[model samples]
Target: MNKQIIDHLFEFWEQIGKHGNFLTKENGFSFAKPTNGSWPNKVFDLTMEKLDIHALCEEIISEELPNSIAVPENEAIKDLLRSKGLRATSKIKAMTLDTTNIFFGNIDASEFIKVGSPTEAELFAQVATESFGYPVDPSTIGALVDKPGFQIFLGNHENAFPSCGMVYLDQNGVSGIHMIGTKAGYRGLGLGKKMTQFLVNQSIENQSKEVYLVASQAGERIYTKMGFTTHGVLESYSLSLH
Candidate 1:
């Protein structure tokens, strides 16, 4: 599960880089332009080998959370990041759920959800921005629609598209659920959970054996109730100088 967690992240970025015009990837690092600054651009795959901290620090252009790196949860590693003038901004749980182990008592997430369409990238971005209070470029999600191995969905309620989520099925049949969000006005209605369930259901339908995500504190409870177990922790770091 740990290896899958790391590989899925790298592959997910690879898919995004393949279609995002303003995004670039090299080795385990990826970047988004300032215009698409709110996009999740970061460094990952640190467990495979030796890390070149000096070169990595040079690539960091800001101290913001968006300009972050995904690193293993280790005291020594975190101390090293801080020694290089970086700060630990977030500690998130890396969770995993085997599809066969799920037990959704009665929460039916079968609400109407539109499969991602290439023409609706702007719509996806619109819902995402409204939900997150951040600017998410259309291309940030648009380039992913109609893409293979990725199943994106828009949740509809009361004739409004206020929620969206995606499931990325990696080559090893590991599904990663990401970007599950509902607009501020539409939250507290269990829409977020529904979107997550919808993504998980899609993974089961596609024959993905395991599902994973790095959950925020709020999302951790929801996903845990959905049968996901915390496998480990992942910390995000950003250079102090920018």
Candidate 2:
């Protein structure tokens, strides 16, 4: 498979896979997306050889993930890319682990989950702003909330509302812990550590093969304590949507 297409597919997956509609327009382009959740990270790999863009698009939509919309702009580019033979795919890997000798406590996630949506991108963003301290807009958070495997665990109190952490399940049967944080007042009580383990245990209960995540430098040690082993790293590249 094309690495570029796979990378785009992984981005789409990370964004909830609903964004597939965005790539269907004539000007929009993608290489490969996931079919039914196997190796979800594979969706982000870019192959070296360039295939017929239009034919590739058709093949991707027709075979890989057929939910693609029918738009004039997408059709035109499909034809053009097919002629150019410049196929792009992203390179990435899947992470996994076995559920043996794991240490964690009950998730108790639903206790703090007051507002739950199948995929509430708006609220997800609001909670992230307070949790991450970076004032992220809904548009940016919406992309993540829409991804295939996204779940939010939050804790709220008077004058303080923070998202405890976020977890997702990929097509590869590996669960991922994206971001985990607690409000200033809620720190030092082990909330951050527990939430991380909660998601890991949850994945194991669901029969997931492994759990993976791109952790911040400081957060790496937290995952390490929870029986998570790090073998390698994953990086991101963009082509300037402008």
Candidate 3:
């Protein structure tokens, strides 16, 4: 349970909700919902007690918004999700890279541009959606622009954004790389790898001593070759409410 990456995720949700959205933590239940009714209407922090899982599930089923719960690899939690007709839509691993004695060769970062404007954030969101097949709202991207301890980047492709990634430095000096993606037309070009390394390089430059990421199965292989080792696994039980 030494995983700070999961904690960072909750913080990530909290930050997103603070910007023209909603975030609430009370009565052993934490909620984050976006105004656009897009992805990541979450009920996380399962360690909290007194949470009426049944009632919550019933509410979600009754609503018309998409919802997902961050379920850990616990049989009890899985059983509860199954009882509510929830399905495992995705699984991710928390991988870590010790920055000590790491190599940072000459990095040509001329193609990477840090997101600074609302327009750029929109393009970043578009690339992310194409890369992951999930619609990432530009509002969320816009909120994080210029936010402290968080940095977003896009791969400049002849004045277009074909790839993108983000890095967040937590209070513990652990930087997390998130949402690394390349547009569909831009795949098979090693852009993912380059985007990842660029984010890592940026994290190291930010003076972080460690780096971690929540990686899907497809991304796990890419990080493994980069010397990242799995520290924990997270299962997300999704409900297609809409």
Best-matching candidate per lDDT = 3
Rank the models by TM-score, top first.
3, 1, 2
Alpha-carbon lDDT, every model: 0.74, 0.48, 0.79
RMSD of 1: 3.1
Consecutive 10-residue window with the lowest summed lDDT within model 2: 37-46
Tens digit per residue, CA lDDT, model 3, 117-223: 99998988888888888778888889889988889999876777799999988767778888888888878988888888888899889888788788888788889
Better of 2 and 3 by TM-score: 3
Which structure among the candidates has the greatest TM-score? 3
TM-score of each: 0.85, 0.55, 0.90
Tell me the tens digit of each residue's lDDT in model 2 across 1-242: 12222232354344543543222212233332333422121223223244334454445454543323111113344344445442322223323345666646555654456225534545655666566665544444444543456665665444345545666665655566655677665778676766667767766766666566555556656666666555444433222112
Q: What is the lDDT of candidate 2?
A: 0.48
- Candidate 1 lDDT at 135 equals 81
Candidate 1: TM-score? Answer: 0.85
Clashing residue pairs, candidate 3? Answer: none
